[model samples]
Target: MAKAIMVQGTMSNAGKSLIVAGLCRIFKQDGYRVAPFKAQNMALNSFITKEGLEMGRAQVVQAEAAGIEPSVLMNPVLLKPTNDTRSQVIINGEVSGNMSAKEYYLKKRDIVPEIQKAYQKLDSLYDIIVIEGAGSPAEINLKENDIVNMHMAKLAKAPVLLAGDIDRGGVFASLAGTMMLFDDSERAMVKGILINKFRGDKTILQPGLDMLEELIHVPAIGVIPYLSVDIDDEDSLTERFEKKGAVGMIDIAVIRLPRISNFTDFNVLEYMPGVTLRYVKTVEELRQPDLIILPGTKNTMEDLLWIRQNGLEASILKHAALGTPIFGVCGGYQMLGTELSDPYGVEAGGTISGMGLLPAKTIFEKEKTRTRVKGRFHSQITGLLSELSGIELEGYEIHMGQTRPIDHQIACLAVLDEISGQQSEEYAGMCDHHIYGSYIHGIFDGEGAAQALVSALLKAKGLDCEEISSVNMRDYKEQQYDLLAKGIRENIDMDQVYQILEKGV
Candidate 1:
């Protein structure tokens, strides 16, 4: 069996995913065949692998760092929250069914075999596997059915390195509290500890570090500084919505919905030099920006209601009336329609009204559309749109609702089935209202698409700006990992960490 080490966090959003990714890159750079493993991931944020298998996007990023293609084995089980009470379950990259939290918790024991299989397969292929645990292992109520934290470490016989977020304060309590919560045998699996997201003056933390080592009986492995990287987070809690000094030459406001799904799509904009991307969570916070974005949502109706309740609907309408360019993607697209209908209750139970910005109606269907799409930018706005004509864009679609444009001209932006060469205004520019929506996510990855959209918005606002290219995510991630590795090498006990890796659990 290949040597393995588990990165378990003291709590959720303690930088476990990103650290695992950096470790994967570091191991790969050292000429070892490496892979990323997560026994379970619960998030609405997911991605389709090259093999068309659905999995958590965090593991996908880690796999990329490891120089390996993403597969179902990387994330054996995924749970996408559909509502407060219900979640859609994905076993081995396939949707199994919807289950309540209690139901799923009780039934998780049945899936241990599947988790074991994924681990065994990756162990056979890789020289080392970097495992990431979900949330914290110290949840007392969840300890009995914990397949992701200690149980996974035991299953793979992997020693653990517990990570604590010092930036959040209470680092000592988090570290010491976690250790105290674990049973004797389970606690033994933890060989060392790594402190993450430290801001300044490492010497200041020496006393705390000494105390943690003494209390936990584990050596301090690393003190990682907080590094600013534009990688996507797995859950909405850690999602970055605002940027400091991002009031660039051109400004864009992304309407942050309650159940926002693909906010990561705008991560590309943060690194784009000429643009400032802001996520507006409230109507009062909405400003007269150059462009307004309505991002995708997991529950369009519920979020639409939230928008209305929070006065965002009126704010968006007021902005649109001022000739503000509004763009919607996926569920956001569905909201642009006259009405949103979920008769089958595919997403949430019942029908709800929308902002009616576009002359279209959305119907939630039974079957989920999960496929990568290819399309060309329409040049219908000849004077300005001509510059964008023939621009190619590629993205994946994982939406359940379909929108039908009331007007034919508004449907010119998209060709749902590009192979058939059929054009539909519904997929593209729906109206002269400067409001557009699409089912595609990650559309800004393309240089042409990002430039064209920004140019149009800038032109509409009569602001002069140069066209900047979209971000190169893989290169960006590699750079972040390299920096993290450098920080770890300078601050961490590399000899002790390597010893833990070399020794079996």
Candidate 2:
């Protein structure tokens, strides 16, 4: 059995994910076999494990901070919203079915056994389990059937660290109101209250912190300063899309679709020196850039239609014709093809014309392709991108469409499955002149691939192509984890945290 502590937030995007990740890293640094657990997660951002099982990406990031392999058991239930009302429910790494809000709420209790089993599995393998809660524990209407907040804490026999987002305003009201809403037993589970995203002097906050602790009968553990760490985010609340930097030496524009998923694919590109990456939602925002990117989306057909209706499709076509390099990944890859056929009614039933950037036709299937892959760019690439040839890359594929390119278009990558050791000759991605399309989600993650593309872009623009130092994505992430742990250690009282875990509920 493993000792546990849960992190519950006052609301969504209250920094629960990062805090839990920081704690995981701290525990790992302290020489404990630590693991992260989130019984239920609602996010479009997801990852495919080595076993071809699907899980939330936030847990994957936490697992990385813990210096462990990501597992589906870390996130047992994942809800990916397809639209405003319905979400595709995944239990234990496999898709169960789509369910409406009411349907899921009524049936959520039935999945408790699965959650317990997954938690027990991690508990058995690790010394400590750091659990993360979804949204708030104060949603009175939804609290009865909740398996992710106080209910989950009781089940895990874990003391809770309730966090309030001071940055969002009314931190005192939110924390006090949340505690007021809880029953006596539920309130008893909360051992500490953490004020997150604070940006001010500690002396001024000390008065409020003392008042809050006295009001709630719980200790104020810490007030974490606003951290600006480069890491993967959970959902649409991510601030990456809002960032619009001035055009630097190298500018890259990514089309922001309505249902964008895995936009973190471009995170590494933003870290490169002399490079500016921006997500453009409107056609007017898509100014003349060195490179244009069409990112992944959840609803391929609907978002493609949105692009066409909003005039972005025409603008992208004009840019592509004028020799501006264009690249697409996953759903964006499907949109770049000559046509998209949803015969199985996966997204929207019927065949629709594509952007015609690539000589490929995509057909949506019921069964999704989810796997981790590693490969290198094909030797025979065309035009300015010939420099990208032989650049090795590794990423994962999570899509419902299969694209088949015409004879003239050349295959870009020759991939191999990481789990099955299956070698696939020219299994993924295609290129035509300056336009490129691929199903690989993390195509730009590798140092070789990103550098090659940047160099090629500079060469096309008739600029000096300097040999930049390669950045290993794995090493960069490890450095980020260490930074996160350091921040947590400096701000929070680790002795009290350890004591809470020692004397579990």
Candidate models: Cα lDDT each? 0.80, 0.89
| Positional deviation of residue 328's Cα in model 2 after best superposition, in angstroms | 0.6
RMSD of each: 2.8, 1.3
lDDT of 2 by residue, 344-408 (tens): 87787899999998889999988888888888777777766778787777888898889998765
> Cα deviation in Å at residue 161, candidate 2?
0.3
lDDT of 1 by residue, 382-487 (tens): 4333345557766677877778877655535554434223343335435444777777777676565667666766666687756556566667777876776666
Q: Distance (Å) between predicted and true CA of 134, model 2?
A: 0.6
Sliding window of 10 residues with minimal summed lDDT for model 1: 417-426
| Highest-lDDT candidate | 2
Q: Once superposed on the true structure, which residue ranges of model 2 sit more than 4 Å away at CA?
A: 408-420
